[model samples]
Target chain A: MHNEKVDILLIEGNDYEAKLALHNLKKHNLTNNLLHLRDGEQAADYIFATGEYEGRDISNRPKVVLLDINLPKMNGMEILKKIKSDERTRTIPVVILTSSRENRDVAEGYALGANSYIVKPIEFGSFSETITSLGLYWAIMNQEAPYIPNNLWQSISEA
Target chain B: MKNILLMKFFSTAAVTPKRFHFSAQKSEFEISHIPFKDSGVSVVNSSGQLLVAKQEIDTIETKPVMRTLHNARKIAEDAIIKNCPDVICALDRKGRFLTINDACVLWGYSPEEIEGKFFTDFVVADDIEKTLKAACACISTGKRTSIDNRCAHKEGHSIPMLWSVSWSADDNLFYCSGRDASDIKSAEISLQESTQRYRSLFDYNPDAVYSLDLKGNFTSANAKVAELTGCPIDQILTMSFVPFVDPEYMSVAAESFRKAAAGEKISYDLVIIDISGNRRHLNISNMPMIVHGKFTGIYGVAKDISESEANKAELKKLNESLEMKIMERTSQLEQSIKEMEAFSYSVSHDLRAPLRIINGYTKLLSNEYEGKFDADGKEFMTAIIENTKYMSRLIDDLLNLSRLGREAINKTIVDMNLITQVVIHELKMEDNSIVADFKIQDLSPTVCDQRLIRQVWTNLISNAIKYSKKKGTPQIEIGSYEKGNQTVYYIKDNGAGFDMKFAAKLFGVFVRLHDRSEFDGTGVGLALVQRIISKHGGKVWANGKVDEGAVFYFSLPNS
Candidate 1:
């Protein structure tokens, strides 16, 4: 059903890290319906279809949001808070894909309703391997949240 | 003196020559007969040693003997009363004096004056009862009795005197004789006073005072000793000090006792288990007790030192804990340093990622423009490759320096000579252009972190080889010796030696003295060597002159 709808939302602040993630996800064919955002602020807007995305569809929430902790404007932890606290967006599982492996960050990320915590390492092929498996899981294996069709998404946005 | 009077009376009754003998001295004496109607009596010396010398028997003259007896009144009056040295007096039954002698004057009285007064007037009031008893005995038993009493002297002081008296039944009077005794009485009083003073000092002293016999059995102990030993005074005195001493210190206790018994003043510290079985430390001083110039016993004074000893031990414990806390804080600081170094190293190591990206994209550009670039562009490509490789080497060196800081020091005994040989062997395997003649001396063993020390040796030796390689036969000497309580290992090289002025900068990271074209190096070798050696509580220094030689010395403190 997601062939016509967005399936995964990739949020990354670092340009290079974003390039690597997007490149690897495309290799698994999971990038076809994916939307890439640079910061937590845009990721949250795209998810809830508010602010700059005022007329955007909200019902077609991505099955998962690939997140980064270090952001330019709004940080990942704060974005995770907005998504999980709202009834309409709370079920969209968020996967943190930051380079930081600090225990405090991992613990705080999960406690704020993040679905999974993954530390991003820059060691050669490790980054590619991590994002590929993550893309395969969320796009192909993981079931979407109630499968809201395009028309339903438009209605939810209009309301 | 009285016996001589008796002999005189007898000789007179015998109607012979009428001679008399007196024994006051070892000589003869005679008292000429001038008979009074009152008869004489016998006499006594204060020492009682006098005896009548001879008795001349004139038994054939019975009439003369009877006549002598009839004149016994004369014998009593003249012999005992008149000649006695003591205060002699005759008192009637009413206690009135009838006759007084010359000694009465010594009591500030005369015979005529005291004869009519009461005998009690001459006796001290404190001794009146005793003096009267002596007077009454003469009347009741008709026998002589003496009592020591003080007679009141006219000057208001009392003279202690001994009086001998008897009753004359026919005359109804008591005849008394007194001798002075003030000297002996005063002496006895002084003795009593001194004994009380000494006793008070023994009983009232605050510190424990104990007396023991020559056999070490407790003779007596004061209240303070009883309190110190946690026993009653009476009970403690009944026991020897041996039971109170801890068994471990028994030998020392015995030695102290021996020295004290030997008449030497000795003192020592011992643990005493008091009555409650609590161990107490006591400082005891002992000396021999002497009586009549003979060593009779031992006396000791002791004080409880348990509290002071405990305080000293507590101070020592506090000092140890203080040292341990300082050590803990120092190690915590060291841990932070290691963590900070690891952070920097990890960041540098991560730089390899973007470096990989740069390398990949550059290759991508080069492939996209294959054969499309001019010679100048090709030269630029080569320069990029050269710079990247140089950066890679620099990053590797940076990581190594930081790794030395992060690694835990795993110390093991290392043979420096063997380690040097192995490092040189490795250098040959890595770069055969490092052709060198090596001179290695026997090196002492050192306890060090083996892997880190291997890195130290590798860096120092390779620098020595790399620098001196221009020599036809490159010379490098590796040796270790002791200096200033540290093991100093040095590497000497016959190569491009910098001036002594530049020696200070030799170990700075990325500081190279020579031109890069002359010798290819990362300029981090000496800096890494210095870092590793310093982590092992050592320091590195170099001494060199232009073109002569260079010697790098590093010293490790013996742990």
Candidate 2:
């Protein structure tokens, strides 16, 4: 499991929301290497290779991280800060997918360096369409940052 | 003896037969005769002495003439002593009264009773030593001495006496004259006491008290004046008050001084810099010092008021801080309201996800198990989907109502006639099958939020059309008029109007007058209209009668 390369990292606390997002992503055949974490802490552990995810390869980063603002344990904002602040994972695209349309949340999400901010729709058809389009755009169409070898990235960070 | 010598000479002259002039030349008498006109004659000698002459000799009657001369001298001595008002007395060397005048009776003593008594016996005990000392001084120095002493009267009361005594060396006596001084003594005592009282009043006063001369130099100042200026009394007396006065108040001080010097009393307030260089505010009053009807200079008193000025400044600062605090609290209240609205919006957003899931699953079940289910099962699924959709609509309406509370109204001048026309055109396009007569009147323009006012028109006109569609021939009338400072617009319909009793609840949220079977509505359109009008500082109302007609009105400020 630690040796596999992941494509999408979905951090969602609610079971129904997680199921819906995964089902929609699967229906579109976006990625087979998707990893779903129930809370912000597990997502941080898996991303930073700390605590339960210690000894995992430190450079096998995901292509995109889908985040919810309201989560158990560490919340989505703290996880975003952790992911964006680290040099190894800084280039990974973070998309904020939450049920909140508050102006403050959108502003805070963008201010913390979120790549994309999308509000989750309430109707099933709209929610399905939004999730499916997001998968297609981030996983298939958009170009990701060029990856550097682990030792080379360490040398660059040191410089 | 002199009278006898005069008698001898007159007897010799009476025997001579001529008018004789007697002249004494070196202890001898020279008698000469001149031509005589009568038997008895009188002449004056060259030394202005009187001489008597008689033609007949009278040597035998000389004794009787001497007796008459002595009696005449006695009468003259008695007249001099009887008329004098002062007590004139002669004292012996031993301080005894040798001879007292008739004026001794004024002291309740006759001259005869006082003549042999010691003078010290009549002097009061308190003054006996001073009186004896004056007598002794007069005798020893042979000079006149004056003393004030109380003399004991015979009636047991004392008289204040001022006495003058002289020592006569030849006679070995002291001649004394005394006068009553009771009135002058009492007047002097009262004057001294009053002067002391006024001096203390000036010294002990809390305010600085001082007097100036005609030259504006301090003539006299009390203890408080020295304390107030932080200067010594001598220094203040030498210096003019001009140096102590603050530069700004120099003119005011001069004017007050001029008024006081012109015989007018004046008072004023000024700031002064004391010797220690501290600023003090003083309220001063001055009075004219007049002596014998002439104006002199100023009298002043000053009270310190710096503390009160500072307190006034402090109170003004406190009032400003209080206003700032009120503003801060108001902004805090607004922030909390915004937070609460955000919480409700999130809650409404979160509620939709479950509803969507339910609607989605029910549809899938109905479509997938179409052949296996009965008619009742299909109907249940449909009911669930419809109700879920209705709930979703309710959430959206609630969110819109809450959002309106926080929305900033952007106001502009809008043409009510054009807004009504556009709304009517839209309503007709929405339902072309409905037939009605529309009466549109000239509507006034008003200042309002254009978009919100358009919503108000749409809600009112749509309500009018929906409620009147059952009529045989629906009639809808739209118009506006100027009412006071407001532009009032009304939409009237000849339709199934509500009862007048429930008119008060017409604009309340979720309050519907008719059953859902008769009328289809969310009961939020009128509420939204009411809220929009209120936000624009306007009003909304309605008038109705069951089955007759209904008229809905809204008013906006003209400016």
Candidate 3:
């Protein structure tokens, strides 16, 4: 179960800025198995198997998780903390996409265990290119760590 | 004819009655005559009877010889009486008095008394012996002479007199005449006083006065002219007056001298260069003078006017510098006006573009997709539209405040109570939910711009309403009071107050004291209020306690 591979998990706000980014990822076929979670809490349940997270395997995780900071309910920073602190989900690849070009947000995103930080551009052409390159890098080229449960005894049997 | 001639001679001789003679041979031959007083001849016999006397024949009495003798005596007597001076006396061979005239008698003596007295008694004691010797010498040598001496008068007082002495040879007497000499003595005293007055005026005059000859040379000068030119009086005598003038003005000095020589009284302001080549201002007054109908040389007076000329030049320089400073200040004021106009255009054009986009899109979404979307989705779009509208109002107010700070304010006396009341009424009309309690104090008069102060009141009262919306009654009090030399105004609200820690940021643009959910405001209100107050040369600030109340205060200085 720890060796099983998963597809994409998308976390964003305002369908306008995030949908424009998703249109370009389809060119590289990185949009396959993509799921759009509207806020930080839905993204947390998809990764953590908590609250209404029934029939979800706690060990299987996606190859890439795209996050946006400006969101309703729990912000992306609190979700990043939950994902990095859990033993079984610590090895998932996470990328941040945000509308703000402020240096404060960039510094804060990387400090919270986000693997990559990308500023969403206003122009459709530039936004598409940034999203395509970032999606291809994390989904295909980068290697992810094996998920480990809280009890280490079950991890040796799965390997 | 010979007998008649002898007869004529005898008869003419007989007319002088003092002659008595018969022939040269015999006296007793019977010749007799009576003598007349005027005629000197007489003829008589031994008897005292008339014999060919001057009165015997008419023809003989008419003889010219007798007539000539009588005429000579009358002339001598008339001359003595007519031409005698005030003091005349006759002296004998021994210097004794022979006779005295009426003039001599009036000299404190009687004619009979002075005739028998000696002439030396009337002479002064100091010169009596000398006068006697001079008189005796003149009489013996047959020469006439004169002398000046004091003579004694009959009243015992002496008078200065001049005596002229001459001797009569036949009578062996000396004649003397004396004239008074007192007029010459008084004329000598007047000459000395004029000399003293001239010397006093020469030493005391302020100008350097001097007299020059026909050639422009110094004849005499006072001490100041020598001191001013740094030359001694002896040196000035040898040096010509031309060398003391500046070299460039030498011809000017010569022309002045030429005019003076032509009998013209002329004056000129001349720059005189001394031995050290330092220029001085000299006012020279030159005049040609004549003494006793003879043309004398020019007289000159020179005065220093250097300080007055320097003061005039300094005043002119100060006036020029003052004009330059006024021109510089006017240009700086014009430049600030241009910059303010540009800032207003940027606020209206550049800033409004983005806000219009945010507002227009949100409105389009609500109108077109309101029925299809859930309730939460519709509410989110409405909030965005309201926030953008608030931002546009904030921009308009801020630009107006910035313009007030840049432009010059026209300060005039205004009543604070009336201005504050108008502002409070206007704010209440805009939002009826805000209940206002105006406890306005009788504010004193102040010198300030009325328009800028009105902006101050509008901003402060509106902020009180925006923050106090949560209060049940929404109580607000606006009032003013006098403190020392300033009039302080306050708008107090019982609303959601801010933390004291962030009170420093209350007057900054976009510095919100309350969250957007708790109170709805752009946060630019207090900033605009502060700027408008500052333009009128006043100050603004706020004080508060969290959740209790807030008070905004501003002050104007006593003008």
The whole-model lDDT of each prediction reads: 0.76, 0.81, 0.71
TM-score of chain B of each: 0.44, 0.49, 0.46
Native-to-model Cα distance after best TM-score fit, residue A64 in candidate 1, in Å: 21
CA shift at B53, candidate 1, in angstroms? 16
Ranking by TM-score: 2, 1, 3
Q: Share of real interface contacts recovered by each model?
A: 0.06, 0.34, 0.00
Off by over 4 Å in 2: A1-7, A24-31, A48-50, A54-64, A80-94, A110-117, A141-159, B1-339, B369-373, B415-444, B461-478, B492-496, B517-520, B547-549
Question: Which of the CAPRI classes, incorrect, acceptable, medium or high, describes model 1?
Answer: incorrect
Q: Write the per-residue lDDT of candidate 3 for residues B377-472, one digit (tens) a residue.
A: 888987787776777667766766565556688888988788888887887787676664556667676888888777777777677777777777
Report the error of model 2 at residue B3, Å: 86
TM-score per candidate: 0.40, 0.52, 0.38
Lowest lDDT 10-mer window, candidate 3 chain B? B23-32
Question: How would you order the candidates by lDDT, starting with the best?
Answer: 2, 1, 3
Write down the DockQ of candidate 3. 0.02
Write the number of the candidate with greater DockQ, choosing between 1 and 2: 2
State how far residue A133 of model 2 sits from its true place (Å).
Answer: 3.8
